[model samples]
Target: AQTVTQSQPEMSVQEAETVTLSCTYDTSESDYYLFWYKQPPSRQMILVIRQEAYKQQNATENRFSVNFQKAAKSFSLKISDSQLGDAAMYFCAYTDSGGYQKVTFGIGTKLQVIP
Candidate 1:
């Protein structure tokens, strides 16, 4: 059984600054996908960014980007130009591109954007 680990219990980023959230996973499968999901206190899980295992390029969405290291199985999320609205609990998720897929999530990192 594989699992995701988040070393940081909480993180704070000043408005207009940038912050990087660390995420690492353990897995034996070759083909899979990594995702960064943001869950606000009053909102549902939202897909922030995703990366394909085979893709060489790191996935990015607007101010959100991923530092995906396939060899080390590390998928970190970098939020640029942080804002108060960006404050949320970020979760790293994983799912294989095969039958009977199961989604695994990390504990989560609580992000605070201080104005």
Candidate 2:
């Protein structure tokens, strides 16, 4: 069984600034994938970044990066140069490797970008 937890229910950041959203997960599986997804007002789940349990290096996509600590079971997202478009409901998700795995998602943290 796997469970994702986002400690902060809400967060705020200034435009062009940076914000880091914390996420932690517990899983019995040795091989799994961790992900950060953004859902805006339109309700579309967009993949921000992904990290494999076996990888030693963290994953990053442009201004979005992840601090993946397998030992601590923590995967936090860092958004650099935050913009208005970055304001959304961010969800931390997890899925085990291989066939037809079910993705477990956190309750989510709402990010507000202050102008």
Q: Estimate each model's TM-score.
A: 0.97, 0.97
lDDT of 1 by residue, 93-112 (tens): 99989868688999999999
Error of 1 at 9 (Å): 0.8
Best by lDDT: 2
- Which pairs of residues collide in candidate 1? none
For all candidates in order, the CA lDDT equals 0.94, 0.95
The digit string of per-residue lDDT tens for model 2 on 1-115 reads 6889999999999999999999999988889999999999999899889999999899989999999999899999999999999999999999999769789999999999999
The CA-based lDDT of model 1 is what? 0.94
**Candidate 1 versus the native: TM-score?**
0.97
Root-mean-square deviation (CA) per prediction:
0.8, 0.7
